[model samples]
Target: MLKRTRKHIKQLKRSITQSLNTPGRPTLPQDELNIIERIRKAAAANNQNNITRTQAYFNFYQNHPEVHWALLAHLVSRNAGWNMTDLKGEYLPKLLTDQEQVDFFAFLERGNWLIFQDAYPQLLLYEESKKQKRPLFHLLDPLNISKFMKPFWENMWSNERKEELTIALIINEQQYIEKRVIHNTHYKNKVLDTIMFKLQDVLDFNHILIPYTTPLQQKTKLVGGTVHHFSSVEDRITLGKGLYDLLFSVQSRLTQTVKWAETNPHTGSRKDYWPDLFNDVKESTPGQVHELKSSPCSLQVKASRIYSPSLPSVWKDWEHNKAEPGDWYPNKKMFHFVKQPIKQLSGDIEKTYCETIEELEMAAFTKNTFFHKK
Candidate 1:
């Protein structure tokens, strides 16, 4: 596996080098330029928020079902939405200050937004390529996508290597965000390096959940894995690959998960998946003691639902700083993330999540009761 990954990386690096050495832009026909303009417009339009981005991915998957990563991205983007709304949700406001919540949301939103803008155009261009019935990936440079991806897209078109294409995209996007979000000095201090972010790690908030329904059951069942070290590009890639396998390896999972996404549009609320445990509508008054009637995975028969707000309710759209130029493919060490086998993960996170919430609530209650004198 290591040898094969090394060879692949060598090939990718050579392609990148060649792309760099040959720098002049190729002249495109007016029709292709028009197609590119339309793709850019579509990407920008859908890049508004988590809801739009999630819907865009699902819609793209519907049109190009062969691109398995679109479905995976849609589900993962749903989790991103849930995570964004979580800052304003019942427990987090107690833990994070208003500014801190804003900072954290910006972090998540920036990464989410960046990925959509970068990947959506690629998806649209691929659609155009299918329409043109030829490889049009040379347009990738014009789209401002990383040269690292051009080789993979070319290979995907010629060889029809779907899994490789998926993995390549996973690597490309993770690396894309590594410097722009994870390692950005501002975010490093404001969000990633903060104690609250560490608390998120300790509380297992990094778990990515994919909801699917079984043949006999209409209720949603989650099947997803967690990424332990979000800062590491390699770990994110590994998590992405694992998720891709989990989603596509099982036919029923793919079908049912798509159905769940289609039936429940993403509103940036956990209620989209588990309405019994979560509600977009606030049921309890803020800062008031409410009875905790929920267990690990469910609420009691009459328990009030927990508040999980929609994205727009809390955060307006943000215009990000222009992405810093340069690609993140610097070494062969990245290949370690490429071909490794990830252990299959089970979706038993409700108990862990509930326990984390309880722990956060306890800490908040203690802080409020003792630290803040009325």
Candidate 2:
């Protein structure tokens, strides 16, 4: 028997009944436990949009007594060839209906569904069990089995169809068992947040096009279970390009005018970013040093500096200037042309991330996952 905190159990009971209408207050079934696990994975993978729909899919499985789905849940646990941890594999099935049996055998031939979306073909999206279990839901009469078959599904089962069926079976079983499942404190992090963080760990956000709280259709290159991680140079170039495009677009907005220094001068006053200046100046007063007012300010200093198409934009890869060879010269000065115009740019580019876009996620719980409660 699993234990829950008093407060959690109360909410748990309510969520169970409201969602599934389970008779009498009872503990979760094994399928419900597994559903919790699946939810954890889906959340971890940054697939929150599928969360609600999937829960609904599972509830339908449990409620529709006509569809026996107990065996389906069991199939999801098998290791077989596909990696279950990564959610990639062929799902297991049991042919209770005559049509299902026929369709199942047809898969032995070279028949499969044709997918059109631009996505990783070899990369398995989700994994399911290979060995099937017995059905929990059965019809009142034996003859009703023939009527349940869909014409399309009845034609012939392809490898893709088999995989789809496995997915369906997992969802169906959840329908009945979901309400019984308890999320508990196991929900250590927001699913969407976790997904985003993981993606960041692998690649930059600009590289991935996952919209918040939505089904993801990413075009990726996965070698084995891992994505083909781009080189650091590639990531920098991509990020720089995205920023350049955005900055340029905003510059063209023209609601506010923007102008740049006439030369390749470092003028933008970086707020709180000044280095420790080596002051070799002889001061008249120890504490009261005069603010060396040199020409007051530069006229070109503006609110924002935007990269325009006509502007000579150089990649300016960070390379230090070569050391100068010196002859016997008297008091030769080295001048640095830094455009220091205070109040030149907005007070730091305030970055904002929508809290509503965040989601709950799950993982095995690493040491870095925990933090002191603020």
TM-score for each predicted model, relative to the true structure: 0.93, 0.16
Candidate 2 Cα misplacement greater than 4 A, ranges = 1-164, 173-374
Model 1 has an lDDT value of 0.82
Predictions: Cα RMSD each: 2.4, 29.5
Task: Give per-residue CA lDDT, model 1, range 290-366, as digits (tens).
Answer: 34665636664677777889989988888877767876665546655556665565556656667766776676666
Stretches of candidate 1 exceeding 4 Å from the true structure:
1-13, 372-374
Q: CA shift at 290, candidate 1, in angstroms?
A: 4.5
> Against the true structure, whose lDDT is highest?
1
Instruction: Tell me how far candidate 1 lies from the true structure as C-alpha RMSD in angstroms.
Output: 2.4
Q: What are the per-residue Cα lDDT tens digits for candidate 2 across 1-374?
A: 11224653344234423423323334557764564455345433421112222232233334432222211211111110011111110011110123332222222110101000000010111212212232212110111111112211221122223322222222222221211111112111322124433442333211211111111432111100111232232232223223222322333221111111111112111110111111112222322212222211221322221111110121111222221222111111100000111111221111211110111111111111353111
Candidate 2: C-alpha RMSD after superposition? 29.5
How good is model 1 by TM-score? 0.93
lDDT at 295 for candidate 1? 62
